[model samples]
Target chain A: MHFNMKLGLTLFAIYLLFYCGFVFINTFSPQTMEQTPIEGVNVAILYGFALIVSAFALALIYGVFCRPEEEVNSTSDPVATTKGDV
Target chain B: MIYDVSPTAIVVFLLFVGFTLGLSFWLGRKAKSSEGYFAAHGQIPWFVNGVAFAGDYLSAASFLGICGMIAFYGYDGFLYSVGFLAGWIVALFVVAEPMKKLGKYTFADALDAKFNSKGIKLAAGISTLAVSIFYLIPQMVGAGVLIQPLLGFPHWVGVLMVGAVVITIVVTAGMVSTTYVQFLKGGLLVVFSAILTILILNRGLETKSNFKELGPVAWDALETAFADKEIEILPNDGIWKDKLDSDQRDYVVSRNPNDPPGKITVWKQVKDANNLVRLLECQLLETRAGKRYINGLPEGTGEGQAQLEPVGSLSKLPDDKTETGPLGAFGFIKTIQNSEVKLWRDDKKFPSLKNGDKATVYYPKLVPGSQVLRPGEHPKFAGIRRDGIFDKLNFLSLMLALFCGTASLPHILIRYYTVKDAASARKSTIVGIASIGFFYVLTLFLGLGAMTSGAMDVSSSNMAAPLLAKSISPLLFAIISAIAFTTVLGTVSGLILASSGAVTHDLAVSFLGLELDDQAQVRLAKIASVVVGVIAIALGILFKGLNVGYLVGWAFSVAASANLPALVMLLFWKKTTKQGIIAAVIVGMVSSLAWILLSQDTFKSVYGIADAQGVVPFSQPGIVTIPLGFLTLVVVSLMTGKSKS
Candidate 1:
């Protein structure tokens, strides 16, 4: 539970940072409408920032929602850990 | 020194092929079970799998196409690089973990995992095959493109060689060998490309003597809205005779609708006995005729080597002449940005080539130090400048493909499965992003370097980067060209692997409900690989001279449309009914495909007509098709699945 919460918070923070960076640069870029010819590298960098944040955001969601590891005490039911698990 | 297509390069390729094939054999021995063969028991480490993602994703299109595009077309080609990389963000965020958790083996598995519906499987299987075949054409075409210069062989020979080698790789090993080979090639591609970038930086920038240059030769090509004319200009460099002569050179030129009308002046020449540059001027004339078909422009020069001020020292020459050097990567942009270079556009053509009787100027005179790249020099991006809202929408629609296609590619999706679990999937995706991102940055340099490297093949843009290398040193040229040829090898293997998996795992096994033994499944996969390999070879030959990147765009749109909706809904939407999945997959796949078949690309490329009349309103189908797919699934499932209660 703790790890999941921490992961979520970390992801949210990263997402915010990236979103802000994208917006800030986009707002300030004098000719964002001019397209990739003049500032091709910058356009790539901005989009990349957005993607990074989202990738991590999805990662955190997965981490938080995923079933945590179960204790082997449940293995008392021998059939549970048997070879036919598939 | 024009390096021999050295025995060393050939030996290197054969050795690489042999080693990889041997590895496949060993791995095949261990791949006795279905799970082992299809997914490697999901045991590959995140790091290895990540590089393999690069291996799978980079394909010949990424390496050869984008680099070549950037080499010749300037920033327009980099748009593809940007589009491809941008697509990955969608994959990393939306698709990776969900895809890993939902289903096993093929894309159809997830679509049918819930209701065990044959309809979903059948639709998805067909979609996979269609998309895979579309993707394969470009790789095969790339194989042919690289073969000509690399081995002094013809295009068809290259295509055949690639087919044979890739089949052996896939048949012997299946995904096991495919993954490792990708990992290996992926690493080498990045490393060598980085090395190439460093070399470019070291060479700095320079000009070439006017004396040593080659005429800008035009191949017998089909042009849209074209005319040919020539004019004379003063010799900018000392190489040309002071007066024009009709006897020496025969310059062939053509004008397209996107080009200016009258004949601008230019010279055709090789720079410093290496770089081939065309110095062009803006044409200003009205349906006028000119002399100099042979003189072309005897008093003037063709778009020849615009004085590359001579890099370092002129080879075999005394210290009497000018001493300059090659520019760093992106140096051409700087040369144009500064007053250091006065580059010309194509001068052999007219000033006002008409598109539907309207004046169209493809290359506008941007005096050196202008603040823009080639604005409408390329026909594909003409949408960027077309007046009215529809043009803007066209540009936006194309962007949609670049954005959505990455996240949805089946080959890229399967890489997430190669790693053990979802965490590894995420990690691997991150690494892939980093590696892919870095390479894209290098493309900007490699491309502009080729564009102004005074080494461009006007007849075939595919030849841009290799020809650029040839301009530098034949030895460096040989190594770079050979490496690029191997690039096709790495990418094609991955696409074949993905398609073969779809055949054995999705279509034959799941959809048909056919049971096969483990060994039998492996055999089926190998056979399927060979069959697909043969198809790719045939199509590659059929589609020569077409841009491989444009070919990949169709693949991206199809993959995005067909696979993405089904995969996403299955993972996230609990009520995504199996029948709904079936409908979504079929509709998404078919609609996007139908849209593409009726697209301008099909008109121009597949059917040798430039008529946009029969074409659909849009260039890329992903924007509409992807959303429509989701809607079809949601609406159908909501109406159908709920009523079952």
Candidate 2:
């Protein structure tokens, strides 16, 4: 497997672990979810927001690591490189 | 029910429509060929296509439906947002690069790429059409919901207007125009939603104390009236009495003083054979110039009519102050976490008629902020609290469907073709995820904001966001609503375009081998768009009052079951065959669709049949049908593996 693909999948798996854990916990342990992990912040709301933020972070990470080596060498602008590919 | 045609809203709406149409016409000149019409000749920028992806994906369901759901049901509505955004991970990791590397116009192109089989084309084409049409229903319904309040048009008129406008968009420029329109609306939606969220945070949480006091006063009067039959109640107390059937069986009424004068509240005294009143069923009655309006409309009286005043207040502040004014994002959520919110609960009962009007009442239940911020508030999500076996399974199934559905949705998949290559597809998917993810986070605030904005229309939960916007200012309402209407337009256009591509490219050319020329194919696709638009309009009007997000859940389940299994197998498994793909698509689509139609939710909600008559045990079919799809594909593939090249 490509290093980029492996890294992307790794991040993806970790993200899913947190995401699915939050969901399962919410389903099975509603009392735990109702608890405020931080001051005035319920676990459910905190976990939900975390899941969304992690998705963006992972996407950015994947974009950086997964960019084709040839394109990286040829152009600095990712958009320009993609536009030029056609 | 009290919608007056807003001239400002009408002007803004007209301008948006006119601008979209004008852009479509200009873009149409460039889309003379099949490739340009269907895929924009793969020339669209990755950034633009990415935002357009958000535009396409964030349909009326995400904006209007999620906001409304959260507004009414609290944290459970944001679960839809969570499920929705989680699906992007599947799209980005599993589907994006491969999809761009394979297919050209429709999703069927990718599935049929390896084998070039007619059965694959036929099965996949049908699935695409089915999913697209199912998805279109909600967008159309949302359009009607928006039009009723904004332009004061009836529901069907809004549906027709959207159908005509979207059909024009698809026919004029296809993917190119659809892409730009989605980009425009997608950007506008996020920005305006952020502005709205800021306004909500700045305004902070305020108490609507009138309803809180009214509840106690009404309860006291009812006790007194039941005790003394001849007691004269003061009009200022907003309590009245009516005796039924000359038996002098008195029932007390409590009117919403917040409502306009002449609205009626009916209290029915249910008496047993012993002539003793056993139960009091409160029903809201509204007679506007002689036309009886029950539960915000003349047609449906059984629907709940008790409009509780917006009743969320800051119970405890983070700094031990009364209100944490103008809190940051984290602070905003924290403030809500420490507060008490009055969420209304709809009491479900068989519709009862009173004095020639249908009446029902929803009682407001006060919930602590901790409870409101937690999962399992909505009835659909009650299992999260109870942790029952079937409830757990249903939650798992819904989550699985949502996670898998984004990659399989025909409209979302077709956007891959609008970009240049696999790398562009990857970048665009990333961009789309970022934009969509940010918007979804804002949805949590937007929904919670609307929940306490004191401007909710209890009759339609879908109107929460627009009404919340209106609460801020009329101009903001017009802009947000106009953008929301375009949100419908952008999504419906993409869906119609995908459906048309399936008809022209996959079904006609691949399955039937018609051998049509390029221009003829584009023309044929245009014709298909019009037909699909009309079907969508009809379905939209038919499912008029159903929640858009709930309707979208069905679409996701169907897509995940039908398309995801075959696509995943073909991409990952070595022994997958054309016959296997065909069987999987057919079985998955039919079974899920059939399951939804037969489920208990459908029986009680859609068909109005008794729950006991419902055929299916569960409402969601993802757990069963998705696995069934994979199993069918594997078995069929092993049987037909010898024939594989």
Candidate 3:
């Protein structure tokens, strides 16, 4: 497996988990988001901004880490991984 | 609602449009070949392509729809920003490099690269066209909404103007010009939005609303007007307009014979729990008439005439401060958390005392700052506060669509082919994420600024950011409006390009098995762009006055359902067959689109069928349709016995 693909999937999973936390909190414990965790900003506002910033932060990490590998494996030969049937 | 068309705005808008057209014409020579026309010869700079992604993604919905929503509804609009930015994460990590490596032109190219099947091409091509057109409707509608205030043109005029200009852009230079235009607009949009946010912080929150300019009568004056029969009190037909009973109603309504028939303009006299009087303006426009009218007179701010004044404001400041002068970023939000905001509420249940007129009263509702900063303010996100499973699912479904939709958008996907190499694609996507993320963060401030600026149009949330700019300065409004118009142009052009590519490259060359050379294909693509542009314009004109944000959400749902499952499974799972991809695209597109059409939102807003529940469980179909898409693909692939990989 290409390091880029492995790294990309790992980062994706992490971000997805973070994003799900946001949706879950907003849905279930909306009162929890109203708490002013920071000096003036509430958790809703704080977490929303954090999500936006984290996307960039994660993208920056990916750009810094992904080295040039064989491009053909990533695009032309996408079926490199033979996973189980869905 | 009749904004005095500023001469400065007209000149500035003309200059921006002129510059864009000139750029397209000069770049026309470079796009003679199909490769150059469709993909810019894969020569777009990584940074430029990245900024173009911001321009393309922001659309009218992002800049205008989101800011206006945040301004009016509070933090719920910012929820869109978070969801939208998160989608780019999917684009960057999973889709960007692979899309760049596989496709030559359209999104269909990438899907068909693995399996050169005509059925896949046909299904994917149809999906691209459907998704692109669905996205186009809102952009075109937003364009018209913008033109009304800037050019003093009617909505149809605005739609036609955008269509003509965008058709010119796409036909002349295709992707090359679209890329450069997006890059320019993206840079300008981000920079100007930052400036606008700074101005908002500098001109801090105030306790008093600034709605006096529209000349709302005092409570005593309303009583006098009612006594003199200048206006009549509407008897409550059992529905209270903003907590006021029919006997307790303070505002009066009157319509003269000289006023445009079937049009109603409302001025609200709202008294809070403390009996503090607040004035608000609202309008229910009937635009089928030949001439525009506001408050029973011709639309203008002249003698015996009135306009819908700006509405949103802070009714109370924290710690008895009438105004918090020049707050810091965090300080601004904190201050709002402690203050009371005067949000306008619209109720359409009232039938005008006069015969055959539909009246919508927009009254000011004072809400705590903490509530405004939470998620349940807008009806779209109001589901979160409910215990109903379907209600909760609605919010979750919307967020899911927004999270998964970005990587699936056809217009966004076609952009990957414009840059050379998979590495450049990856780098440009990072740049896109940075630019889009920063802009979305600014949307929070822009929306809050507009919310507190007393410069919001209650009738249309799409006008919030531009009206906020107008409040700061007319010069700023002029520049911002021009930039916003260009924002629409950039996104529409990209969508049109995708549609055209689908027609010529996928539908004609691949699916229909046509014999077309490079030059012929480019010509056909240009012709196709014109047809799509015209269709978009017609739809824009047809769907006027609908909320641009909701339409955009529906587009996201459709895109996420149709495109994401096929794209993801093809790349990750080996058992994925051509039939599976075909079934996924067809089922996902049809089911999601059908779901949206039959949803309660459509029943109420689009079909005008009141008092009927939608057949679907929720308005947004992503939660059901996205999983359904994946399940269909897997089941089909297994049944087809796919092992070609």
Interface RMSD for every prediction, one decimal? 7.4, 5.4, 8.5
lDDT of 2 by residue, B408-472 (tens): 99999999888767788889999999889999999999999888877776567888898888878
**Number of clashes recorded per candidate:** 46, 1, 1
| TM-score of model 1's chain A | 0.45
Q: Give the winner by DockQ.
A: 2
Q: Write the per-residue lDDT of candidate 1 for residues B1-645, one digit (tens) a residue.
A: 122366655666566667766777777675556666677667688988888888788877887787776554445666666667766666765666556666677777656656777777788878878888998888888888877756768989999998998888777766677788888888877887787777666665544423222234332121211234322233222222222233233221332333333433333322223333343322222221432221122212335211111111112211222323554444434443343232333342322223222121222222322322433335666655555555455555566666677777767776766666666777787778777777777776676666556565433567666666666666666666666766777778777877888888888887787899877888898788899999989999998777777778878888888878878787667888877787888888899989888877688777877555555776678778888889998888887986533
Candidate 1 chain B has its poorest 10 consecutive residues by lDDT at: B305-314
- Sorted by DockQ, highest first, which candidate order results? 2, 3, 1
Candidate 2 Cα errors over 4 Å, as ranges = A2-4, A67-86, B209-283, B286-290, B294-324, B348-356
For model 3, the superposed segments whose C-alpha errors exceed 4 Å read A72-86, B210-299, B642-645
Top-lDDT structure, candidate number: 3
Model 2: how far residue B568 lies from native, Å: 1.1
lDDT of each: 0.62, 0.80, 0.86
Q: Model 3, residue A16: what's the lDDT?
A: 99
Give the chain A TM-score for each candidate.
0.45, 0.73, 0.81
